[model samples]
Target: MIIGTVDCFPTKSTLSKLSINNSQNATGHWNSKIQFGHRTVNKQGSPLDFKLEQAIVSGERDDFVLITANFTVPPRSTLPVDYELIPGVGYYKLHKEPQDWHTARVICNKEGAHLAIINSHFELSVIKMLYNRDPKLHDFSYVGISDLQKHKTFVTIFDEPLNATGYTNWAPDQPNYDGNCVVVKRDGQLFDTQCNGRFPFFCEQTLGK
Candidate 1:
């Protein structure tokens, strides 16, 4: 299971080398293939054997192509993505910088996850711990709570009622404005922020096991 980000450009080139985490144990050798339509386009003549964590990819892109591998694990093993794992909950990932709520959610979806879901106080605490880990990172990031319908009621991206989470930690007089998105502050309190505001985000994924 190799889970990681990738930097790409507009070129007819290939990834010379890259590393991804692997959760599988059978590591003798696996065949590699690069197919475009009906043609094999590997730069190398033969399908080479890859190391457990190393992968070789070849492609010709005239335009931009941004591809990131999602973490994969066996059905019997624990989750294997490279992110903070909440034991009873699931996996969570904190982005490096701030982005609008919509962009953050889109990116998280691309990474095979969604914005962090705060269903309990413990889950919120896990998000806070992840936020405080980096001194360079700000105190808050976008979570999955929002009032998309503008009905004066909040709900999670997963379709759960926010009040039902039973773990409201809003700041003083927070959500007093027209803002619909939720953010976790440095003081470990949640606040309602504008959806268009750019803030770092946390993504959550369930354990496949």
Candidate 2:
């Protein structure tokens, strides 16, 4: 009785190192092949001795061979590429490209995420760290706060009041502008800005609330 389960958790760098081969079968069907030979490690940097022999994956119109080592990746370890999961918080992606608030929201929505809404000081710190990862990501980035519906009454994309997020650390004398959109500075403080102004933004996908 051999029951096996496979989980895949590859980082951006690891994915780039993978070799994918596409070839046609004898029945004139294309088969996808992925080879993984790199060392697998856990969070503690300990090497895991798990090797894959071969796996046949049933496809819609065809079948493919998935070859890998014997490894068990828990559900929590599996996450979408390009998103960094903050424990007890959520997954976040920082877009370097500048986009207006509305455009940013639309893009995030398309990706099954929303413009990032700060929930706590810890979350705010994580966002600040991500925002400062690249030197080109200077200045501020658009978040999910806006006063579009009512003047000076900021609400998140989820329609929750900004104050309810438990993180209302606004920049010194900020909200000074007669703007509807909000931006979080590198220092982890919020500021009101015009919705039409282009800026890099953060997208967040939350798990069970």
Candidate 3:
């Protein structure tokens, strides 16, 4: 069943859901929050011919409609463009353009992602591999972890303790830097650095849970 505010669909038939096996020309907006193949009091999924019968209301752009259907979604279609899948990790995009920590965070958020957080050694290794491939990238790239709330007490951008992330591979004498933000060196080691220092960064997006 399609749910959410009526602003996005002026009439009951303004939006419809479709599910056809191997069907062509079936396109719709994708959101990670929607779960497919589920039957609940508030949510359900099935098939119907999708159509737009009326224009959306102005100044009602804040709301949205979620339509779930049982259809095989193409693997490549689930990811945003320019993102490279890192196997077990997630889809990531390396932003070569320099930006400070706050700006980097905002940009990634606007892109429907967050600064890449190294959750495991395997993920760090993959990041290092990507880093080594491009020699032009800055030596230090901004990551999602920082000690912004409490000096020397590191945490992920989500405010989770860094130690809880399963990986804390820091360089020798690291956390020694006076800065409050974190960065990942090309060698795959974490370091604390100035939040205002501009540098390249990685953004990650996990989709279709």
Candidate 4:
């Protein structure tokens, strides 16, 4: 895991460059402030093998003119296995194979984090990084917001009870509101979904105190 802060312009370039090789592994957003890169480097200070370099160079340069690159981490090993953890990000392990929305929330809360809340477009992109990695997990899974009273549905993680007024992006007839749980989909769309649906869960924890 490599975490860095780049200027808006070069960030787009890096993203575009990375996407070409690993479309499923790259993500970017308008106000990320920080970007996550999956590239790895070997112990000898050489770039390790990864498929993230081809996605950006397919002539999509114009879409990434406002991005920049800041910092990068070379891979490291601990006890014969190579693993890297970003400084300010949080990760959770699922105790069971799959958990429902409510169960996931409880687990995250118990773990000292909480069901991830998309506070901004930057955070939304982070959620997307987690959502797209697993197909067994539904495209959309429960987030941390709800509206059981008047709306009978969950609000978005951003806490917008009502759709962003003129910026509604729900699927047709969404917000059905059977159980009042918030869910985020692979495409970053939000919907009021039932809490009973089983899916892999994600949590957010503050870093560095």
On TM-score, the leading prediction is 2
Model 1 quality (TM-score): 0.59
Residue pairs clashing in model 2 are: 51-69, 51-70, 52-68, 52-69
> Candidate 4 lDDT, tens digit per residue, 1-209?
23443433335324222321112224552333333444333453323232333233334455443444444333232211222233334332322245787788777776566676655666666666655556566566666676755466445444565444223455667767665776667787767766687866556653432
191 Cα displacement, candidate 3 (Å): 0.9
Residue 189 Cα positional deviation in candidate 1, in Å, after optimal superposition: 1.1
Estimate the TM-score of every prediction: 0.59, 0.62, 0.61, 0.47
TM-score winner, 2 or 4: 2
For each candidate in turn, give its C-alpha RMSD to the true structure in angstroms: 16.3, 14.3, 15.3, 14.8
Candidate 1 collision pairs: 1-22, 1-23
lDDT of 1 at 6: 41
lDDT of residue 55 for candidate 3: 40
Worst 10-residue lDDT window, candidate 4: 16-25
lDDT by residue (38-60, candidate 3, tens digit) is 22112222222233343434455
Most accurate candidate by lDDT? 2
* Least well predicted 10-residue stretch by lDDT in candidate 2: 40-49
Query: After best superposition, candidate 4 residue 63: deviation in angstroms?
Result: 40
- Clashing pairs in model 3, backbone N/Cα/C closer than 3 A: 1-44
Q: Write the number of the candidate with greater TM-score, choosing between 1 and 2.
A: 2
* Candidate 1 local lDDT, residue 70: 35
Q: What TM-score, to 2 decimals, does candidate 4 have?
A: 0.47
Q: What are the runs in model 3 whose C-alpha is more than 4 Å off? A: 1-79, 207-209
